[model samples]
Target: MAETGAPRRQSLGFLLLYALAWAGGAMAYVPFLTILLPARMTALVGVSDVEYLGYVTFCGAVAASLAGIAFGWLSDVTRNRRGWIAAGLVLTILLLLAVPLAKDVWTLIGIILLWQLALNMVLSPLAAWAGDCVPDEQKGLLGGLIALSPALGAWSGAIATTPGLVSVDGRLAVVAGLVLLAVTPVLLFGRPRPFPELTAPPPVCADGDVAARPRGPAVRMWLARLLVQIAEAALFAYLYFWFRSIDPAMQDNEKARLFSVALTLAVPVALLAGRWADRRDRPFLPLVIGASVSAMGLVGMALAGDAGMAKASYLIFGIATTVFLSLHSGQTLRILPRSDRRGRDLGVFNLTNTVPSLIMPWLTISLVPGFGFETLFLLLAALAAGAVLLLATLPRGR
Candidate 1:
């Protein structure tokens, strides 16, 4: 690999810039289940009878994965990552505004697909930008920043969806508007000083090989992370419904509060885990421990048929998952094939995250309906356990 100079420790200003940008990008993503397409909107579209919304979401994931790969590759080819990022922000804002206006399921699906593609367009390139500027030494901090994105998104989305703040559709439009407005200054004024372009291709191995090969340990680790994410997606995407099913009297505001609390706890845990992994060079340990704990949390949620127990389960699940994800992401940065192609590879790696969402609707709608949420939670627990086993088989390194 063409080694760049020692990675400069990114300043707090830069990290904040990236985090805010990511938070804006996140509003396009994390709120879909929680705020954007709640039951009311589902009923508004008249596809409530069939599971069309699930299929729509699946298609959105597919679009996001494909767009992420495509845009990441294009950013590499063009050597102009910022331009793509700016364009994606603009497009996502516009599409998000259009979503509430869609009168039919097909229109909503179309808008969602486009919005996902636009969001990925920015996300893939931005992730690559991190690898481009940040060195291995700073991976832990970068991972922490990345982990914060979801929490920030959830927090902002909850605020936007608070009752009487705006109608469901109007809230989405406002979210889109706010993201667009906030992103504009960053994209326009907070310009990063340009770095010299890499005139030569990345270096090959000692034997002069150029083809990218998936590292064995890394692939194993990726699979472990993938399974961990599957459990997470299943729980997060359906947790609101799970709450409602468990307590029919639960208000939307209360559910949002619980979700916020869970995320608030998760953020610090993730940051602490990332810092600890960096200092101790014990990346795998956190993942293994986190997965095992998360599985236990899932089991707790399953057994907790009442509201109080469910709240406790959410706390456990949040902490465990946060730790696992932070360590897992840091480890991922260490294992990717090409430092120069971090965006492309990470985008591919992200498939491990996105693909589960594509499949989860099937599990949630088809399987969960037949077997019930308790059985589904049990399956999630099993998946988390499987992640632990997979991680156990991987070779450890600093």
Candidate 2:
């Protein structure tokens, strides 16, 4: 894809407001997925937490993966990214509101599956919209801004799970309100720039064509993200359960606070990393450094023996993962080889996101029960290492 001339830089107000909207949407549902749903599953299912979580997450992942692809492709065809986002957000809010009515384990799982599909409908297009509107030079700034999402999501979880606020209906109402509030800025004041009109379609290169060379780094980027995503999914999906196992006295709010702290710490780091990349015009360097640091954190987690040690390791891992992911998200916009099919391509790239959730559940089931969490951490560390290796293969100035 040909790089455009220096486009006008977006105003700081616009970026900040847009970022807030993004973070707000994340806040609405992430708490439910990460903290509340697991607890509900544990209560409903008679089986072990690990077993039930594995099944539920796998099913949700399947729906999310399919919906991301389908909706993303639809956005490309209709050129109606905003409409998809709005509809998805509305549907997701309705589904989340109805979650309190799931009286049984199977019903809860069904709702979660539907929720996942709806959320992906919003998420995939939101992602593609960024690629479509934001200029290349500004992607790093955008990445820094996007780093706020996880922190907000964690804080939202804390609010939702606080004592007296833990009921499904209560949490759902608050979260849905926040989602609407968060997206309002983008919807009302900061409308996304329309994508350029579609011109003649680019010819697809056949196998053995010289045009395929440009895709090599893109492929490596995809693999690198997949590995990091796997490492992240493992910790994110099971962190609450793991913390409780380590310290039975630990409260959900405390765990959520710790997550918030870790992500909050990463916010400035992401801004700095993104700014550095923008100034130097070298995004890949930050990605490599971030990956290597994450591997170290996973190794630390594997070696921990007690709750205190585990918390420290998680802090390290959390901070590193946010930086890696934020930078990776920004750089993705830069490396994608095709501009015409940006949404579809990003949907395929998003397999790295949803696919990891699918596999992590199975990985945990296989390793955590039989081999222990230590073994699982070690395996995740290996995956992070693989990410580092793959990322190192990209040529400079990528």
Candidate 3:
């Protein structure tokens, strides 16, 4: 396979545009999982919310894992990132619009599973495009920009849950509209630049080249991300429920607003961290710090006795997680061995993202109902600490 060679540095304007498109795509689906799906599941299954959430998330995880690899490989074969993303977005919109039609838990599960596949069809390739196009020098900055997505996603969720959007169908329509509007800029200006020259991979002997080993850093990077993602999955997918559990009087929109505020505050912190890492060439440090900081926040949340304390704890956790994740996303592009297989490799790495979804619900059910959310939060803190340790092992400049 021919490589696209090193992608040239993009101008700030182009970077911002790309980031906005990614943010738009994120908004389309994140709210559904973070806020809408859980709410819907509560309404659909009542007392069985934990069990049903586990079932639905497990199914979605399977679909996401399968679809990520399949579509990622297909994008590699087709070399058509734009086409795959556009198709995925369209299908996801249609499926989202149909969400209100689900009359039973089983039916809703089926729709959500399909929605997972469609969402990944967009996300996998879109992630690969970053690996394909973004240069290493700018990855941290890009990561900082990517932090904005969650902030925007949370805000969009707030919009969806607003009082005026009385029906599920109406909320879905508005979210879909926002997605379309957000992605329009990228669709208009996101053409792949001509590669000018195709590069070849280094020759490998039968046993593989010992002088240069790319697999170690890549695998370690993925593992580091996995731990943090597990922590994040534990928080993100259940954030709404957790907040409501802490404060029954809190409105859905208020939860969304607070979530957005936490993420929004993290934006500058993330960007600064990214810039510092890029400048110092100590990217791993930020990842470690992020994990450590988040673990602290989780510990605080676990020990909190009041809603106010819990909210403050969440704010800390949210900021740290945002920084960790955004930087991780940037650093990932720096470690890939083969640009030619960016899509497939990234899809494989995305398992860290999908696999956590599979584990988190079961983790929640096993712990939350039996012990309490405190137990879950403490466990997540331990996992995050583990992520910090794992990241500490990476080779410098990796």
Candidate 4:
């Protein structure tokens, strides 16, 4: 196999368009979980129970993981990654429209399962596609775009949840429309040319000359990423409830505002971290340092009692998370097994992302009642610590 050279930088217009499309598509799930489904379940079915919601979300996570892996594999075989993305967006839009009609928990869960499956189809491919079109040198900018997804998604979700501005059903309808409208143009107009020149590599020797094979250090880096993501997912899965527990009187707008603040802090930090990774070539050190710092933030949240302290805790959490994620994203392409299999490998990698959601429900159920949310944060801190340890084990190489 020939070594494909580094990719050229993508135009700023392309990045903006892709980011906007992703934001629209990504917003659907967060608001549904944080605001819509809970409200709807409470009003329509009298099932405003947290335990039940946890279980439902756990099921959705399972469905999403299975579908992401399945569809991602199919996309690889079909060589039609964008086609799957389009199909997913269409299905998710239609499903969101159908959600308002569900009268029972079972019906709502069924619809949610379908929606999640479709959404994962889009998400897994989209994640992998970043590695596909973007060059290693440009990964910092690409990583910044990737890191922006959560913040953008959170902002969109907050808007959808704004009181009296839109009914839950109305919000769903609007989000679906926005996603479709934003994504259509990108799909139609922003098709990236496959960089064949970059794909071809020089011949390799038996020992160290393999073109696309990630070295030992790179593999270790990716493993550390997997660990860090799991910890982050676990924390994210329960953050809304954590806030509510700390301040039972907290309103939706307040919660949204706090979440926004965390994300606001995170986004710029992630961008800077991505740039740092690109400019300095310091992958493992940044990941380790970021994880350790984030663990401290989680510990602060775990121990905080006052509202002001909680706000500060979240700010630290956001900054640490942003730095960790940005560094991870920038380093991932350097460690992939092969350029051609980027989609498939990234899909597999995303299982690390999805699997934590499956475990979180069980973890919450087992821990929260007995040990409380504080213990959960402590456990998250431990996970972050583990990630840092793993990251430190990676060999240092270009």
lDDT of 1 by residue, 1-398 (tens): 22367544545566667767766776667676665665535566554633775677688889988988889888888877789999998888888778767887777788888888988888888777765655455567666666676676677777787888888678777677667764566566554433333223556778988755468876877788788888888776777678878898987767766776776677777777767766766667767888999999999988997889988997898778866775576667667776567677878887987888888888888767787788888888999999999887665555
- TM-score per candidate, in order? 0.90, 0.92, 0.93, 0.89
Model 1, residue 140: distance off in Å is: 1.5
- Expressed as tens digits, the lDDT of each residue in 1-398 for candidate 3 is 12447535656776787788788767986788888888888888898886888898899899999999889889888888888989888888899998889989999999988988888888888888777666666788989999988888888998899997667658888888888887767877875443332213335678885323368788888988898899888888888778888899998889888888998998999899988887787878889999999999999999999999999999999999998998898888878767666778888988998899989988888898889999999998999999888888787673
TM-score top scorer: 3
lDDT: worst 10-residue window of model 4: 1-10
Which 10-residue span in candidate 3 carries the lowest summed lDDT?
193-202
The local distance difference test score of each candidate is 0.74, 0.82, 0.84, 0.73
Order of the predicted models by TM-score, top scorer first: 3, 2, 1, 4
Residue-wise lDDT of candidate 2 within 212-331, one digit each (tens)?
227878899999999999999998889887888799999878988999899999999999999888888887888888888898899988899898899999999999899889878888
Per-model C-alpha RMSD = 3.2, 3.1, 3.2, 3.5
Worst 10 residues of 1 by lDDT: 191-200
Q: Any idea how many clashes model 4 has?
A: 5
**TM-score, candidate number 4:** 0.89
Residue 185 C-alpha lDDT in model 4: 71
lDDT tens string, model 4, 170-201? 98886677677767777787766555644344
